[model samples]
Target: MQLALSTLGCPDWDLERILSVGRDAGYDGVDFRGYRDEIDVTRHPLFTDRADETRSRLESAGLSISALSSSITLCETDDRAAHVAEARRLVEVGDTFDVDRIRVFGGGDPEDRSRAELARAGGETMREILSIDGAENFQWVLEMHDAWTASDDCQQLLDELPADNVGVLWDAAHTIRLADETPRETLDALGDRIEYVHLKDAVYEPDHNDATDDGYVYAVPGEGDLPMADVVAALRERGYDGWLVFEHEKRWHPSIADPDVALPAFVEWFRDQR
Candidate 1:
């Protein structure tokens, strides 16, 4: 598996700096949110016009664009239409970089709903996203997050979708956070639809004493209580071959501490994997 870093960690940095930092830190690829201020490549003319130059720059510096993250969410009613529009635009951006995957979230805004409402709405949002025509070569990999995470619900979704492009980006934290399930259960439901994974680690605190995204607290791979070793073994045993990205949402929480601090630990842990 080619290891990569989510540039969502340094939301304030530009593309040049983000690419350099990730390359220097032993990352094979870097995922970005080009639509946002974080690495705002969308604003650059070159991002749209000079594709070869951009790819050349990154390749020369030892990096590739993994995916343009996290622009999709399936939890809000009012923003659902706008969500579809934004997804099309971001997918175009991904096409520009030849990146074929887009990171997505389970919660549109689940903080505003009860558990039942969130599940119902989140599933609906996912269905709409899956119905989009396949123009962009990338696929809609619905990342399992704190919201919309039940194995039954996810299976129900896959049963309804039409194309093989609709799949899962299983985050280890979300599987562990489910009060009634295990990682094995979630992965089993995914089956052939497991497209990629958001590799991370965290402390096992129930209301998440430090968890910012709330499935669990974020930390380096082996730094916290998350069953990183077991999770790895399970994926390997199950024959998962997709990319395993280190997703540090320091932009949302102080989880990473510092890039200088966190990146090295991540590289070390990933390299030493059995």
Candidate 2:
């Protein structure tokens, strides 16, 4: 598996710093979530106006863009057109970066609707997004996030979508923490459609004592009980050679370790695993 780090980890870093540090840290690629204060890469000047320069810079740094992690939520009832347009725009940006995968979120509350309903919503939105010309060439990856952390729920969403380009972005932490699935079980169930993996670690604290409302606190790779090693072993056993993205959520949670401390640490830990 190749290693990549999400720009979500270092939201304050500019594009040059991101590529330079990532290259030096032995990262094979970067999962572009944001750069500096810009939350949307497609709108950012580096990607929109200076796209060619950005690509050249990335190439010069010896790094590829593994994926463009967008905030397009499919299961939401609000602004469906905006969601589809955003996804289409991201696909356009993906083309510019030679990126084949675009990360999206399966966001909704299970308590508000059945998993099937959520899946249907996600499927419909995905179908609409895929209808755009050239959109089918890119994999619109649905991340295991929000209420779709459960493999079965994610499977339900996949079942509703018939397009082969739609795939899963397996976030190991969520499936384990929220759905109570072991690494092997998650891979066994969603292995076929998983196109990318988000590597994060955290421990469950039932008393809501952590940064997360659900009591899950972020930990550097291998420091928490996330079964990351087992997950990697399962992927290898399945002959999966995809991007293993280290998703450090420092942007949303400022209390977490800075990227300066967390980024190289992940590279060392990942290399040790090899």
Model 1 residue pairs with clashes: none
| Local accuracy of candidate 1 as per-residue lDDT tens digits, 1-274 | 7777876566666667777877787888877654235345554565667767877888888887777775556666688897777666666667767787876665644467665676567667766765566533577777776555776666554554434566788777666766355667766777578878777777755585556544467776687877777667778789887777877777777644566667667878877777
**Residue 122, model 2, lDDT:** 82
State each model's C-alpha RMSD to the native: 3.7, 1.6
Which parts of model 2 are misplaced by more than 4 Å? 204-210
Q: How accurate is candidate 2 locally (lDDT)?
A: 0.86
Tens-digit lDDT string for candidate 2 (114-147): 8788888888888898898888898888898887
lDDT values, one for every candidate? 0.68, 0.86
